[model samples]
Target: MKLSAHVEKVPLIHPFHITGYTFTHNDLLVVKLQDGTHVGVGEALGVYYKHDTPYTMLEQVEALRPTLEHGITRKELLELLPPGGARHAIDAALWDLEAKQRDMPVWQLAGMEPPRPLLTTFTLGADEPEVMATEARGFEGVRAIKLKLTDDALNAERVRAVRAACPDAWMMIDANQGFTRETLASVLPAFVEARVAVVEQPFPVGKEDWLDGLDCPIPIALDESIQDHRDLGLAVGRAQVINIKLDKCGGLTEALILAHKAQEMGFKLMVGNMGGSSWSMAPGFVIGSLCTVVDLDGPIYLSADRTPAVSYHDGHIWCPETVWGGPVAA
Candidate 1:
């Protein structure tokens, strides 16, 4: 087997605004593993928020090439690479390769019931109220909306504007750890007022204890706070949900573990992404089967994406065989 990677910069259809900055493009790490005539593909987006870049992923992959080139399985690959973009790209490609090799679909390989169409949440990035509302209005079949938030007074105004524009759409919000303890208390009423279903990681990481003593009007979902199993114990009775990203939790190997652990603790589950094409979204689609909310809209944001884009119709996304390596019954 031969291991290789390349980066592709795919521009977003519009500016993606967050608390402190705007992202115009996604830097994707595309990986390929070839053995003779068969080749498998995978993708990952270097997330700046996590200090992951194309260069950093490349460095890590290069150091592990000796191992990957010598016939590595997806399970072994997880042990070799740390949980992040690089491992995610490699792990996903291996799953694709294995499915092709076995002449069976990924869902079958995992012993999962075939995937039905999935209802995914559309995200409204943190921005000026009116602009965010305008953007929200343009999308069709968006039953659920996840609004981005900041630690500012205007947070309520933004939520209100989006709610007004999307009155029938269910709402959730992610602060991406932008809030302080004081600000969180102040915004709790607004979140409840807006009827926001889940408030995600409002405060910074490692502040899990702050959430333990207080009562929130809305349930909190852990994103940055729940990276691995080590953090799951502290999350007991602390958070109501855990947002599991395959990349953030290393890959499906650990993500599956984290999901079950969070479930045993009675926390709702949400499966999210790092933003990329269908190639990147496929792995998370498996995890979404067990989640309350799915955010696999990464490919939809791109101006162009890999062929056979995941079919998201009427707010429901269906993963296709061309992208997944084998046909699956719905």
Candidate 2:
């Protein structure tokens, strides 16, 4: 078997900013595993918010040369590395390889009875409220739209614009850990008035307990606040929803497990993304089928993606043929 990796810096068509900072480009790690016959590929985008950089993720993968060259099992792969971008890329490639090897779909091997179509949240990038609202109103068949919010004082105006643009749209907001208690309190009322469905990770992780039992008008979602399945125990009662990002939870293996656990705990599920090409959206596409809200619009941000890019024909993303690779779209 042979293992190889490289990084692709994908420039966002438009600069993307949340509350914290603006990201102009994403460094993606692409890995290829082959046994001198079939080839399997996967990718992960470097996430700055998680303290992850392309250089760091590359070093981590290089350090795992021994394991990669040894034909490591997926379970051993999990035990060998802590959850992050590197494992996510490699694990996904392995799943793709295994499915191709057996001539079956990856979902079939994972024990998912039948694959179903998924509805994903159309994300309105960080921009003025009126501009974001214009983008939201243009979307078709998207049951939910997650707006990226910031610490700026104009949050109320932004919410108002979006609500006015899509009065009937099921709306949600993600602060990306960009708000304070006072600021969040001030905006929660406006968000509720605008019928914003849920607010996500308004504060940083540890401080999230501040909202525990506070009873805000809208439900709160935990994004950066929750890490892995272990973190679930601490967040179970505190958060109304869990935004599961495969890169954050390790890979699809842990993501599925965490989703099941979150479901059992009565928390709503929201599959999210960190931004990449179509490849980055593949794993999340499968997970979105089982979640209440889906935020897998990572591919849409890229200038160009791998062939057969996850087709977003209405508001639904099609995953008939892996979507990451395998066949080119006609």
- Minimum summed lDDT over a 10-residue window in model 1 is located at 321-330
| Model 2 TM-score (2 dp) | 0.94
Local accuracy of candidate 1 as per-residue lDDT tens digits, 154-271:
8989998998999988899999889887888887787788899998898888777788777787888988887777688767878888999977777666777888888988989999
lDDT tens per residue, model 2, 143-240: 66888888888898998998888777788999888888889888888898999988899887688677777658788889887877888876766778
Models 1 onward score TM values of 0.95, 0.94
State in Å the error of residue 1, model 2: 1.3
Best of the candidates, lDDT? 1
For candidate 2, the 10 contiguous residues with the lowest summed lDDT are 321-330
Cα deviation of 233 in candidate 1 (Å)?
1.7
User: Which has the greatest TM-score?
Assistant: 1
Q: How far off is residue 178 in model 1, in Å?
A: 0.8
